[model samples]
Target: MKKEASAKTWNTLRNITLVIILFIFIRYLFDEDPFNDRIGWSVLILFWTFKGLFDAVEDKRSGNKKSMVANIVFVIAGLGILLWQGIQFFLYK
Candidate 1:
């Protein structure tokens, strides 16, 4: 029971981390000049992808239905934000 609780806690932390990374990624991806702002976006992408991927695996390991759904929503929304931000800049550029 204790092991299961820790697993849930870890999953929750990862889910939250994923949200933070996603926000950072979108914030950087909106740069008017992506080339000039490569470093910011690069860091965002690296960390976002890393955290997002990590949380996904952790969610699978935990096998908690509620947490899994929540994490999935987070991952989808985060990815959507990144895509939307990228598209907005691309269209304007």
Candidate 2:
């Protein structure tokens, strides 16, 4: 139980940090005014992260495999978005 809690905490923190970094890079490094765009992207990230976590927890409660593959796919998608945004910032700057 404790181990599972720790893993959950870690995943949440990691997702949050990635979101923050993506926001920062877009705001400062890119120097592009993505005010509304930033908000939308942030919301999307938050939604996906929370949804994945909830699904995982529900699966666990039901004695399933916790949807590990789906969770990982979402995480990877989030990271890929950040990377693409970062590269666009660099390339355009």
Candidate 3:
């Protein structure tokens, strides 16, 4: 019972942290500054890349093929976006 409760508490904390980070990332993405845009988007992409990869492994271990594949795709897309971000700066900036 204690272990279950502790796990729940940790899950709650983790979820809260995710939400806060997401909020900050969104703000950064929407800001007027070009650097802010890059930083914001990078934060989200890095988060998605790392979290998706980690979750993919965890899902695979738990035999959740559907979720595992989804995570893998997410990681791929995040990497793609990061690559694009590296190549060019928009004229608007």
On lDDT, the leading prediction is 3
Model 1 agreement with the true structure over 1-93: per-residue lDDT tens digits? 999898789778877876786676666767676564654665575565556557666667768667666666776766776777678778977
Q: Write the per-residue lDDT of candidate 2 for residues 9-84, one digit (tens) a residue.
A: 9768767865775665455534456554654565556556655656666567556764766775776787677667
> Per lDDT, what order, best first?
3, 1, 2
lDDT of 3 by residue, 1-93 (tens): 997897678567666766777888999999888778778978787777867886787688679999999999999999998877766655444
User: Which of 1 and 2 is ahead in lDDT?
Assistant: 1
Q: How accurate is candidate 1 locally (lDDT)?
A: 0.68
Q: Point out where model 2 deviates above 4 Å.
A: 1-36, 39-47, 50-63
Q: How many Å off is the CA of 20 in candidate 1?
A: 16
Better of 1 and 2 by TM-score: 1
Tell me the TM-score of model 2.
0.42
Give the residue spans of candidate 3 off by over 4 A. Answer: 1-34, 89-93
Estimate the lDDT of model 3. Answer: 0.80
Task: Report how far off residue 81 is in candidate 1 (Å).
Answer: 0.7
Arrange candidates by TM-score, descending. Answer: 3, 1, 2
Top candidate on TM-score is: 3
Model 2: weakest 10-residue lDDT segment is 24-33
Better of 1 and 3 by TM-score: 3
Model 2, backbone clash pairs (residues 3+ apart or across chains), number: 0
